[model samples]
Target: MRVYPEQLARQLNPLTPCYLIFGDDPWLVETSKAQICAAAKQQGFEEKVQLTQETGFNWHELQQEWQAMSLFASRRIIELTLPQAKPGTEGSQTLQSLLQQPNPDMLLIIQGPKLASEQTNSKWFKSLDSQGVYVPCITPEGPQFQRWLDARIKHFGLRLQADARAMLFALYEGNLLAADQAMQLLQLLSPEQPIGADELGHYFEDQSRFSVFQLTDALLGNKQDKAQHMLAQLHGEGTAMPILLWSLFKELTLLLQLKSAQAQGTGLNSLWSKHRIWDKRKPLYQAALERLTLPQIEHMLATASKLELMLKQQGVEDWTALSHLCLLFDPKAHKHLAHIELY
Candidate 1:
């Protein structure tokens, strides 16, 4: 019942009784936890009870939570985070007992730091792994790191030209989170052409100034004032209009994809994993998916396409229309756009 981090999603179907996610990498550990939680929610594990193995920890709470019924949901998840990576005598006894008496209504998830050789061979750890899943979140290094980076770049549908690939590899060798973000920005900025290392540096410098990402973040969070401010700043700073438009179009395309997936009755967790959504940012996107209508996104996306064509013309600088396009993402601004057209 051992699973690799990348293979975790395929194995998530038919929920497991227990999942043990242990790792040293923060991003990997957090992302694995999010994926599991997303999968658990789809399987009706709506309510969650969190426990930490810290000072004066109550080992008996696990048993109590297992036997307890939820007022909010019929089924619930019990997440035990072990900072020490080891359960002491009482904790061991409690875990063995809980495993002996498994309850279908409760899903047990345990996470902690990376395990040593002796720790993995322990009786309790073996029992848990045999019964459920053991996901070890070790950060990738060297070639393994390269493979991970390549997968992320491919996921974003990007082509790296000249020394761009080598430069990127050297830039984010050990940091998976930064690599993903870099690729995301690149994907948004240039979806159709091969990008060079020089362009990479230039785009990231502008990103530091108030990234296209920040604007998208503002739009996703429905922060009208912040999005408008960032958009105007980007314009004043000479951000290419096509790049801004492409980023918005990319976000709208994702929204449409998520909406279509929902209509087809897909699980949120699977969609998130397939789309490579990280854990911390799920709430922003989840809110957008729940709130925005398909028709609204389609209409705005159409306008963006037209705007793209218009921006290609010589001597045409329409910052106002782009400002209006940013507002189209706001559900509150729908009324403002209802009586007008932008082309």
Candidate 2:
């Protein structure tokens, strides 16, 4: 009597009198509930009665609604919502009793926030688990997030470059509602071109005001003044810190590649050809390699990776780490080098 989000489309049974949908993620919970409601409606559920557990709510009223019948419709969809997911003695007993005697005329749908482990083991929950359908909504994190975003992009019939996808994930990592809203905006704005950082910036100007590629290029060139100016401009333009950190990380990665190739005694032409580095941009990589030692590149990469972990940690909001990274390239800024490891 349990269903998954992926299986809901094919496995929904309108004949099942009760359904329990509960989760901490509001977007997933609501989306699953909508799908179930649609399935019920398709099977001739013509009437809907909604009930929410609020302050001073009467459980007896739910019992009354359960026993009541509509003259106009033979089948009804009854929705019971518990924001707190705590149905006291009377409500719990009532829910169990409703499940005990299955009603073919009435389809009962219950929704709520996450329940504690003990609450899930309660008599009422057990009854629903046995007779009704229980659906749990879990939020995606890390690699799971990328998979979810890829699926969503495919659903929208959209294409995105690697950098653009990183920007999108950075902007809406933990918030599904915000991600869906941004996707809707992208659908309206760029229906043809493959999405990159510029397109993401163009549409979501408020979040991605500056191009990530430009930031990366500036950092790689080590034009101290130009890099600082662009960094400040990007921050002022309301760019997300994650995108900035990502740009720095990418630049350091490319520099490390170049340094490694040079250390291996690879010819410049062969190195460029092997890595597919464009001709016009070869000087940028060569200049960066000359400016930064292999140890320096490794240290910068280490700091960038640490900053990424810091940003992902819950409830930690110090963006000075991003500023610290930009200062690493500043020739005039040596006071902070004590923290920079040589190797």
Candidate 3:
């Protein structure tokens, strides 16, 4: 009843009784839900598709709906979405009971964010694991991501120059949905041509403030002015500070890992294939590895973690402090750590 994210597309059989699609990636979760619904409709559960959100709702109603047999329709699909379900609550009890009563004609689909610690191994989850299929729409990680991209490109009947593919992977950082969108965009921009690194840069040139690639480039190039400007713009746009920090932290961590792997005599091609590095991203990763010291990278991660905690704390509108942390990475402020520690 458990399925890998990669196999979801091909292994989805119409004969399953229920589906529990849950994960950290919002795009993957929603996409899978949509596909399941479409498949349900194809099986003639169109009019009987019932969707429910689990916040502030009467739990009994869902149980009742599930228990009630269809009068006209031969099949039904109930999609229950629990955005936030506290442990040991009435909702949890209801969910546990519902999982016990599996229906052949009723396709019950439940989804939520990364499951709670207790809920993951709960009897309810276990029941679903045994009876219903659970598709984890988790994001790809490290080198497995490149394989995913290669499959996607092949599916699209497109080819990316080695350098271009590497750059795309570096920029997207294993965010499959973003990479997919970028690939589609590249196809649109140059339909008949295989995209090269230069083309990739040109297409993403104006994305200085929003693009992770541009942000990384700015940091690596020690362009303090542009980095600060982009940080300010992102802040003003109300982009979650944690998201930015997380992305920066992830990229640095990857660079550190890749650097270590390379130091151990890993071949560039082998490393790229193993780490899922595309050809275009090699230059950026190489640049970052050369420019950042282990201590510096460690400090950046620690700063990012602290910033995340500060943002979560009450009444901490410390944008200036956050800005300072980001600006410290700027070449102009490379030696300015004395004042940063005070903040």
Best-matching candidate per lDDT: 1
Higher TM-score: candidate 2 or 3?
A: 3
Per-residue error (Å), model 1, residue 239? 37
Q: On residues 138-229, what C-alpha lDDT tens digit does candidate 3 reach at each position? A: 66644776787788888776778999877776666435677778778877877778888987888763322244555666676566665676
Candidate 2, which segments miss by more than 4 Å at Cα?
Answer: 13-15, 205-343
Rate residue 272 of model 2 by lDDT: 86
For model 3, what is the error of residue 3's alpha carbon versus the real structure, in angstroms, after optimal superposition?
Answer: 1.7
**Residue 294 C-alpha lDDT in model 2:** 80
Candidate 3, which segments miss by more than 4 Å at Cα?
A: 53-55, 205-343
Q: What TM-score does candidate 1 get on C-alpha atoms? A: 0.58
Q: Which candidate's TM-score is highest?
A: 3
Candidate 2 structure quality by residue, lDDT tens digits, 1-343: 6687667776676457788888877778888889988888888888999999999999889887778877886688889998888898888898888866666778888998877788799998998888878888766654776888888888887788999988887666556767877897888887777889877876763332336665666666776655565666677767887777767777788778878888999778777888778886888887877777787778777877777776686544345666666677644454556375422
Q: Candidate 2 local accuracy as lDDT?
A: 0.76
Candidate 1 all-Cα RMSD:
20.3
Model 1's alpha-carbon lDDT is 0.82
lDDT of 1 by residue, 1-343 (tens): 8898988998788878899999887778888889999988888888989999999898888789878889986799999999988898888878877878878889899999999988798878888888899999987764787788777788889999748877777566556777778888888889989999888878653222356876897899887876786777678779988788889998889989998898899878998889988896788888888878888888888888768777786546688888887887877777777457655
Output the better candidate (1/2) by TM-score: 2
Could you give me the TM-score of model 2 versus the true structure?
Answer: 0.60
Q: Could you give the C-alpha RMSD of every candidate to the true structure, in order shown?
A: 20.3, 13.2, 9.4
